[model samples]
Target: MNGFAATLASQLTSALPATAPLIKAALRADPGLLNNCVSLTRQLERLVYEPFQAIMKGDLLKETISKGPFDIVIDGLDECEDKQGVEEFIDHLLDFFQEHPRIPLRIFIASQVEQHICERLEDDRVQLCNLDSHSPYDDIKKFLQVSFCTAAKRDRVIRAYIQEHGEWPMKPDMDMLTEQTGGSFLLASTIFKYTIQPATAEDPTTPMDRLPFALRMNGR
Candidate 1:
């Protein structure tokens, strides 16, 4: 959590350079507060929340609000190894928003529906969206198209196949591959890499040969 807090502080500094002075002032108030020894909540208060609050309440409030409503994206929170830390971090996050409801900031966390995360973030303050309800077929199709095009440019095997075979993976192949992924971004990316990765001595199959194989794997 402290590592996450430090990264957030760095990103905040980069995104809003004008707030650096205030953030630095907060850090100065408590020396070594950015270090790992400090609690995540304390690092957040001194480095992020306090500076953010100061800016929102300061003389330049109108100017900031004019540019208003910033977002902080926290992705793959469920992948964190420390379960207790994750729970504590979520608690701290919700408490911050609850205490300062007027702050013009929004945190968007994208993670699988793990019980610990869901239990904390199911608050009225947070709006939830289930990605499974929405089909990602079109997005996956576009990704495969762009990925194949880019690979064809850099990969001699794909280039040769495209030159000989007209489009390496035609509309029918694309539709099949897209369907095989079943709206999964991970599967889409995995198969893309599997298809285009350079062949080795042990696995000397060319990318031209791998497309059919990838399609065969389906969602496995």
Candidate 2:
């Protein structure tokens, strides 16, 4: 991020524009730095990666970079079309940070678990956690509770029903519906959807008509 792009060689070219000035300034200050470099790759290394790393080091020393030791979030890696490119990115990224341990940058990747990705990331440096292992029962229950309370504020039919019946869904009904959701957020969401929907003249199924039925329909 100092100046080099996220990818190694592929991103090196785009970083040239930003790093060019810094490279020029350094070269002017000391002309003999890359004067002996015969290889194009070495010349490019001088122009981009070296300058970028130097800038990073300078910034780190000065504490000028905001979000020091910042997190780099890579969401939806599994959805990426270029599988090999993703692999290379993970490899180079981990190596770069590992090589520069003092550099304050934390990378966090969130993706649908893929075997190849899992295999590459299974290292002592990487703490691989299974996010889906935890039960979502409490979360789902809380979601339903909050959703029902919010829906009660909006729906006239539900409001009227609550006023007449004390609560649209009694404690037993709430428990039944929450239990029926079975820790599935999708099912919990649909239960709330059906519980708040307005009655149409054609269907004539008001939220009040749907709330009690959701427990029965969704099943315990």
Candidate 3:
């Protein structure tokens, strides 16, 4: 998450060199932007904090407003290299919100449970959800069906298989694979990728046989 923030800051600073001073001033002034720097700062802030805030505030209506709230969606925080920067970034963010209690900014972060990030984000305003707890089987099945259907439309053999079989490994097959996946979207996607690999003369398309292999690969 910190890495993302740094990248964002670096990009914004590179694009608008005057943004840093402006943002600092804006933080001092009101909950919104004042100058061009403030404007850029708000833009940076929006990039990191707006989407979740919009959802939380239920402000889905897209209307032109003089000033808007900040929301952010951050994923893969644990993968970020600079731990100290991430901590400082989060601290400043929390401090900003602490100073301005009514600022309509929210942040949604998705990451594997890492101690430093989790500990900092354990504040009352933060809402934590473990991705492992979410059932991704249905999501994976739908995704696979869509991808396969799209691919089959382009590939003659896949299309012929679907036509001859009356259904291309239909819903039940998808469900079984989903169950086998144990709710890991990554695992399911890897399985799908392996299953769809082009068959050679020696190895005909036996996706069922390949499923076990995919699962084993995932276990590693």
TM-score for each predicted model, relative to the true structure: 0.68, 0.55, 0.58
List runs of model 3 lying over 4 Å from the truth.
1-6, 9-72, 96-106, 201-220
In candidate 2, what are the lDDT values of residues 1-220, reduced to their tens digit? Answer: 2112314333433533455566666568756645433333344446544665665655454563664554546678888776765676677666766787666556788988898788889888888877789877778778888888898898777788889889757777777887888778888898888777777788788876777778776534
Best-performing candidate as measured by TM-score: 1
- Global fold similarity of model 3 (TM-score): 0.58
Q: Best candidate, lDDT-wise?
A: 1
Question: lDDT of each structure?
Answer: 0.85, 0.67, 0.62
- Per-prediction CA RMSD (Å): 4.4, 9.6, 8.1
lDDT ranking from best to worst?
Answer: 1, 2, 3
lDDT of 3 by residue, 1-220 (tens): 3235445644544544445555444346655433333433344465434422333332332321234544456678778886775676677777767875665555678888888998899998677787777777678888878877786787687777777877766666666767767767787777788877777798886554564565455322
Q: What is candidate 1's CA lDDT for residue 102?
A: 74
Candidate 2 has its poorest 10 consecutive residues by lDDT at 1-10
